[model samples]
Target chain A: MNVTDLCGLAPPEPLERILVWLDAAEPDEVATFRLPHVPYPLFDHLTLRPCCWDTTEQADGTALVRIVRQ
Target chain B: MINPEFSLPLAVPLRFFRTAPLWLLLAGVLFLLEPSTVLSSRHAPEALALTHALMLGFAGNIMLGALLQVAAVVAGVRAARAGLAGLMVWLGLQLGVALLVAGLWFMQPLLLQGAALSLSLTLLPLAGWLFVRLCRSPACDPTSTGLAFSVLALVTTVLLGSALVLVLTRGAALPFAALLRQHVLWGSAGWAGMLLTSVAVTVVPMFLVTPPWPAKLVRLLVPGTFLLLLAMLCWPVLMPLLVLPAAALVLPLWRLLQQSKRCVDPARWLWAWGGLNLLLVFGLSPWQAEDGILDAVVLGGQFLLGGLLPIFTAMLGKIIPFLLWLDYRRQRPLAGPLRHMGQLFPERWLKYLGWLALVAGLCWPWGGVAATAAGGVLLVYALLLLGMLRQACCKAVAALVV
Candidate 1:
């Protein structure tokens, strides 16, 4: 799994970058993103896309969101 | 289908943000009418009108709008019938504030009575609803805790304010001085102060790209500030201690701005102005006006215009554009190309507005020609702000149609 660290980038940048990455990924390819926190609003957008994702709280207070293109 | 549980409709928050500038415009008009009366004394009817125009009208609208959106994000739960509830709250506030301002300006007891009743009905229910929602939410983060406390503060402030109205208009024999002090304390430190600090925890890091607030500060700031407010209520001499929280909130922003990658962002300048205002407000104590240096009116202006308005204006600049971008992005399939937030609103406009607001706030304490000019400048600021939001909304709509 490829891991992307998006910890310090502000707002829509994090949401936008991850969506762009997801769009270009191969089907069934899984990627994990380390975010500053749980991307609540991004969940709204992901609901519309053909993707499956799960978020886990990391020990360091960041959120690790793993996404796989469906 | 988008989950209604997780999604907030665009119209809900937009209605509030768009209406905020109108209140500022009203404040400008009141100032223009009689700057001397406004600057004369804090207890003067004209001064009270101007204060309410900013507080209940401008700041109230913005804070409530922000609460609707932030509550959902931090709590991970959307309020039931949020749209309808928001609309009702907006309408009630608009009506209540108009009556309150008119009552103060005209000195009509009947209008004051109506204002008291309308505000109590609207704010109590609204606070109660949000408090219940925050309490039920599983996410117990600092931001959520702050939101809950701010709601309680709003309740205390409103009750005190209503009591004041009765004393003034209904001839109720209450301890007017003590009630007024408590009202100012909770309204400023409890309601407005707490909300700003709590919201900053989320907004500063997410929008400004600052490192998260210190973990210890995040946990203690809200609860600790509330305790101090309670302490001040019991012992008014501890009122000066409230400055500690103000300093704590401002110091981190200055520190972060020094390290922020988006150093030139206009919002950063406004934050600096907000910090400066906090210093001036605390340094020039209202009680120290006995030597004829300044009065409570100037202190009030420092707090509202310099301290609160800048922060609110800067946040609106970022939030309005971002919200428009979000809405446009959600419909980009039909809208064709999505415009970024910067494209929706120009940063230069915000920069200009910030400078103008600073000028207005600085001139507010002086009563004569300077204040008159400040009134004119504030009117322009309000119009420019309103124009920016309207244009952004139009751009989003036009793109969707195209």
Candidate 2:
């Protein structure tokens, strides 16, 4: 499911919150997670991380999980 | 990054020409009335009157009106009282200045007494109200900070003036000369110098499309200059402290010059001229005896007023045309290419005038009569600038209609 569908499934109160995170893989990168209802235009000029949902072990043997909004 | 909301007030943009003609007339009157006083005295009543005419009558009107207009334009808050507030301030200022000048010229105790009180009281509330309005606006910036300091300086200057009036009237109270010295410091350095510098910080960058001022310089250096002036006012013996702020100014000035893309503009050239005039003032700071002090004060005053102010006036000549064009274009869409500011005036003539004024100002101390003659030439130059401005405004309006 897309992030929007995931938001729809969640409680409305929690869906209204905005969550931000920094990517560990690229320390300089900033990520934001928001409800599907939020306007995309607001972030047009801004830098943001794409939402993902996966957990895997890299060739280096380090396990990684997709970060989600708290 | 181009914020339309950051525009200057409607009145501010036109003020240079509106007041320039009057200042030119006053310049003539000042020179004619007291040519001898130019290099021999620190405080002649006629000269003092002319000084106030330039400060309050000319510069004061333009600065205050422009500030009000700028605050409204930039902040997106219309003047609560609208045109009426502006009208009152202008009329009160003009009438007050006329009475004060007349009183000073005749040395009439009754006239000076009443005029001094009236002018002070009339302007005090207007300045106070403007300050309140600026503080409440969302567009408040460094320029506003300068205006606020200017208001404080005006208050100090006026109060000292009122005290001088009282000393003249009642002959009872603190030593008047000491108070007058403080008054001079507050009026010149605090009000005139600080306000001009503060506005220049923003204006020079915007006009030349220079890089943004370093954040530290804007936040620290500008306010530091004012603080030094304040210290000087409170402690006369600490007059030596003037050098501190004067030195601080060098960094921003250097940065401004380095950043400016349009080095050829005569207005930018005036910045150097004003700097030289200021340096001349500083150069004479070491004179010890009264006669030596008088000589320094006279020559310095000539450079500061006759030399530096005319250069500032020349810059305004350049600024007004572009402002007029912008205002006109905003009201109506243009179909073809727009003219640059240089096209609005006789650029060659302006350069010649600037050169003449600079040469005359530098030579005035050595040759008093010749300096006055140069002042006459400066007066004509000012009048010519006014005429050019008038033509530019007319052309812009016509273009907008077409």
Q: Kindly list the interface RMSD, in angstroms, of each predicted candidate in the order they appear.
A: 3.7, 21.5
Interface RMSD of 1: 3.7
Q: Residue A28 of candidate 2: its Cα lDDT?
A: 35
TM-score of chain A of 2: 0.22
DockQ for the candidate 1 complex? 0.45
Candidate lDDT scores, in order, read 0.82, 0.57
TM-score of each: 0.95, 0.75
What is candidate 1's CA lDDT for residue B349? 79
lDDT of 2 by residue, B354-399 (tens): 7756755665555467667756765776676667667777777676
lDDT by residue for model 2 (A1-70), tens: 2222222221211212222122223443323333222211112111233333333333321223333422
lDDT of 1 by residue, B307-376 (tens): 8888998888887777777767676622245546777777887888899879977886765787688789
Error of 1 at B164 (Å): 1.0
DockQ of each: 0.45, 0.02
